[model samples]
Target: METDENIRLRQALEHAAAELPPLPDLAPLAVREGRRRRARARFAVATTAFGAVTAGALGIALLPGSDPAPATPAAVPSSPAPSASPGASYPPVVVEATPGVTPPDNPDGLSPAERERRAAHQQRVAALLDELLPEKVTGIRPVKDEVAVYRITAGGASFRMAVSVRPTDEPLAPCPDLPEERGVCETVAFDGDREAQLMAMPVNGPDTTGSYLRFSYGKSRVLLSVDPEAVSAPVTPRELLDVAADPRFLDLVEDTDARPVETKEPRPVAGG
Candidate 1:
């Protein structure tokens, strides 16, 4: 039924189709590629979600009122330790001595052994005075070259005080003979037959500011005096007498009496 031209055209098309290569089946490769892309997308989504969750947890941990992290412990030394030394021996501690006062020579003509004894006794007495005195008396420093004499600082003022035990047959010092000079004199009785004379005299015969006490302890005359000329509110007489009555104070007097550290005859010292 076809004409010659149609027949020829159909023949040519068939020839061309036969000469061309066969088409490949791309369905499996497309499916594999789609699966791979889906897998990569799921992985990216999971990673982003994990990062966001980690960031949120960190932000909550760093908020105010959160507990702080524990601090790191200090590092211990690696070097070997040295052994401790034995305890050291120390001399007896005494109050500071007064400055600029030269210690006088042995005026009592005491033997070398006696001088050493006296020096030791004086040191004991000085230390005792520092302890027994009132708290107001800040310090009690021994005057240079003097025996039993100390420079006391009280209420920001410097004053002189003497505590001496000398061999004497003299009676307790009496109050001032002058009517205007006589301040307050009283007899204070202590335990046993012990007694002391306490006198408070005026600075310039009218100012009324001095403290003096004298008593006989054994064969020695115990004298206690404080000069409060310009000092305001000097140590009271009751305080001075109370100190003299202390058993510890009397014990020192007893020690000195047994082996006298002072001169039998009173000699004027430079500071005293």
Candidate 2:
């Protein structure tokens, strides 16, 4: 019952979403760094998340670190605007009205909510990054609001893992929400259940009162939580450490950061 004009409008919108630029090459780091990260005790976790977890190895370019072109530095800096898609990675529940990345929303693969959930989950993933990493990192940069991109190497996998601090607004368009002070901090922590490494602490000054850790290795780095009043917003580092320390994060972390990895190759999602 849709008008001919409506059909054209929808097709146009779909094409817009599909225009996303290709991901910047994320090649792995050198071999020495990879080995150091694997030995890190942080690799010991429970693996409760299963399918949701990401396990990978390094082969070529960069992980999450390499400095993005100024235009798109953090979070795939310089990435061409996404080509509007008729369908996101997954289909929406209401197929009749599913408009990929368009407004109104769709439940498909990378729905706004799904993207937010995946983004938030990075908190846990970042924690594992800190825990399992033993070598140096490089290319730590800010992406859209509340998010950052790190380039690290471990477990024979060279790649970048985008990390975040506090929960950000759900809208996918805006990101790299830099705090008012606009500073960096580094913190490190490790408990029996978790381990974390932080760098580029998002703060203006050094902090000690609250447990915030920030540090960098090459380009891959971490962001930790800093008492807003104490200095700046650093929920990134704190969350990552906490996630890494979790007993369930061991296997995932090990597989993610271990070098000369035996197994742990990530199977692409069904259609991904």
Cα lDDT, all candidates: 0.58, 0.34
The window of 10 residues in a row where model 1 has the poorest summed lDDT is 84-93
Tens-place lDDT digits, model 2, residues 117-192: 4333333344444443333321121222223443333332223344323222222221223355354343334654
TM-score of 2: 0.22
Q: Candidate 1: list runs displaced more than 4 Å.
A: 1-112, 173-178, 265-272
After superposition of all CA atoms, the RMSD between model 1 and the true structure is 39.7
Cα lDDT of candidate 1 equals 0.58
lDDT of 1 by residue, 30-73 (tens): 99678645644543443334323322221111112321111211
Best by TM-score: 1
Error of 1 at 93 (Å): 16
Question: How high is the lDDT of residue 94 in model 1?
Answer: 20
